[model samples]
Target: MTRILIVGGGYVGMNVALRLQRRLRHHAEITILDADSYMTYQPFLPEAAAGNLEPRHLVVPLRQVLHRCRMLNGWVVGVDSERRTVRFRPHQGEGYDLPYDLLVYAPGSVSRLLPVPGLAECGIGFKTVEEAIHLRNHVLAQLDLASSTRDEAIRRRALTFVFVGAGFAGVEALAELEDMAKDACRYFPAVDAADMRWILVEATGRILPEVGPEMGAWTLEQLRRRGIDVRLDTRVRSAENGRVVLDDGDEFDTDTLVWTAGVRPHPLVRATDLPRDDKDRVKVTPHLTVVGRPEVFAAGDSAAVPDLTRPGELCAPNAQHAVRQARTIADNIVARLRGRPLREYRHAYAGSVASLGLHKGVAQVYGVKLRGPLAWLTHRSYHLTRIPTVNRKVRVLVDWTLALFFPRDIVSLGALAEPRKEFEFAAGAPDGAKTGTQDGTETTVPRPAGARF
Candidate 1:
């Protein structure tokens, strides 16, 4: 029996896996190994952060969806293409190896980080569901801390939020969170909406650069009208010790810093001996087959597939392209198995949609520009249709319905991410501290006088 192994479970991975199962029957054994057990619909992350959608509903469980395929929840630590074997470390089990007749490499992208000072420790990237939830909690927690503090400077610092990217992720995250914070002000009398500041810093001259210049300018105008500080052609010099110093000479103290600047292919792609492009993405032919390796295929953000439609351009790393490319990849795989001609992957670029908030957004679809409620509706409709599972789609709709009848839940659950930190700090010990139990009495360990928590 032929064995097929797929890495990563994002849009491309899941889509291709489903397509293969539907096309290949039981002749091939399909196995998908992802670092996370659930597939996150990344487009809904901004809304998840704003409490407009439940975080749990944003993820589709692989076990439930891919029932026919063997699902291993683990990280692919190494891939030996010559041996036709892939090694992975399961979430709670020992390392194992799986031999594959054909391999599909789709380990999606990671946060593209720069060498900015203090960014590693203080910055949050808007990619994973964990990051989105952490950001939502952190922002609401800052409001809580601000309301409880009597120091004006401390309150102001807590209320200031800085986003380093003006692209779709950064802009939508900022807009939704800002709207949530403003609505949350009704409950906290001490913290006024005017007291909060939301700033977006982009290195380029305009944001949403994927969209045309006119729509980008219109987005800028809308954001500015909402009192958001949109700084263009600006860069961050440093953000050390809660002090954000911009290249444009503006300096401020802000506790919240989000870095959605960009994304690069996962580092695991480099481990393979396959050919790669200048950006470190695996180089693949128009048929989405890795160069010089007919048994290996790659797609989504990790593969640099040739865009035959444009002749010189590479496929963009967006859901629209990824979803479409998955179909071609599945078809090509079946073709190769059956000794038939494979089809090349090609698709024209569709327009973009960006949600500013609940009733505010900008969209450019098929050369038509739209803004305000129309754009917002388009944004919702497009994502609604794109989300993988019908169960998740209905749950997300219910979440939206609940939001209409009730105020957004602004309570922060920061401790959920690090629940033991507070206990360790109070016990005067570091993480992995020793605790003694005698007759149900808990004894805490004491730390050295100069030791930090």
Candidate 2:
């Protein structure tokens, strides 16, 4: 029996695995090994962070969808291309090897981080469900802290939020979360909406570069109208000591720093013996097969598959290409298994859509530029059609419907992210002795002046 092993259960891995299960007709023994057991629908992450969508609904269980294929919850550490084996560490045990007659390498990208000061300790990426939840909790907690504080400076710092990138993730996240925070203001009498500040700092001259210059300008105008401070052609030099310094020489103290700069292919891709492109993506043929390796194939963000539609350009790392490429890859695998001819992958760039809060959005679909409520509606409709599974589609739609009638849920569950922090601090404190000046006042750790309330 032919054995097929797929490494990574992301958009590409899950989609290809499903397509293979359908086309292979039980002739192949397919197994998918992923670091996480769930497949995250990444596009919904911004909404998840804003509480517009539930974190649970943002991911689909692999076991539920890939019913026919064996799902191994583990990390793929190494690939021995010479022996046609992959080295993986399971969740509960030591590393093991899995041999495959044919392999599909689709380990997706990770947050592309830079060596900026204080970023590692202070910043949060908006990639996974965990990160989204953390961001939502942190944002809400900031508001809570600010409302409870009497210190004007501390309140000001706590209410200030900064986003480093202006790409799809950063822009959408800022818009949605700002909208949520604005609606949540009704619960806090002390904290006014005008007191809160949302800042977007982009090194590039434009945001949503994927949507063309006109739409990008329109988005900037919309955000500005909402009082969002967008700093284009500006770079963040450092964010150390709770002080954010920009290239333009502006400095401010802020607590929330969101890093959605960009993404890079998984580091495991570098371990593979296969040829790679300049961007560290595996170099693949037009048919999505790795160069000089007939048995191994790759696609999606991790693979640099030649874009036949544009002779000089490689396919952009987006769901539009990932989904289309997965189909072609599955078909090619099926053809190879059955001794038939394989087809090449080719697709033109469809326009993009961006949601700028509730009834405001920008879209350039099929060369038609739309803005305001119509664009927002189109954005929702497009994603609703693309999100996998009837169960997910219905649930997401229900969430949207509820959002119309009910106020946004701005409750902070920040402790959930670091549940044991307080316990650890308590455990380390001096033996039941209140360490403070003797004035019958309980000793409290003095937070940094710039730290959030």
> By lDDT, who's the top model here?
1
How accurate locally, in lDDT, is each candidate?
0.90, 0.88
Off by over 4 Å in 2: 420-453
lDDT of 1 by residue, 1-453 (tens): 789999989988899998999889798999999988789999899999999999999999988988889998878888888899998888787998889999999999998998999888888899999999999999998888899999989999999999999988999999999998999999888989999999999999999987789999999998999899999999998889989999999999999999999999999988778788899999999999899988999999999988887988898888899999899989999999999999888788889999998899999998999999999999999999889889998998999888889888877888787666666566654343556577787665665322345
For model 1 the local lDDT of residue 212 reads 85
Candidate 2 per-residue lDDT over residues 1-453, each given as its tens digit = 799999899888888998999888589999999988888988888888888888887788889988999999888888888899999898887898999999999999998988889888778888889988888888888888899989988999999999989999999999999998888888989888999999999998899998999899989998999999999999888889678899999999989999999999999898778888788999899989999898998998899988999998899999889988888888999999889998999999999998888788899999999998999999889998888888899999999999889877877777776566655655656343346567877786643222334
Model 2 clash pairs are none
Q: Please list the residue runs of candidate 1 whose C-alpha ends up more than 4 Å from where it truly belongs after superposition.
A: 92-94, 421-453
Worst 10 residues of 1 by lDDT: 444-453
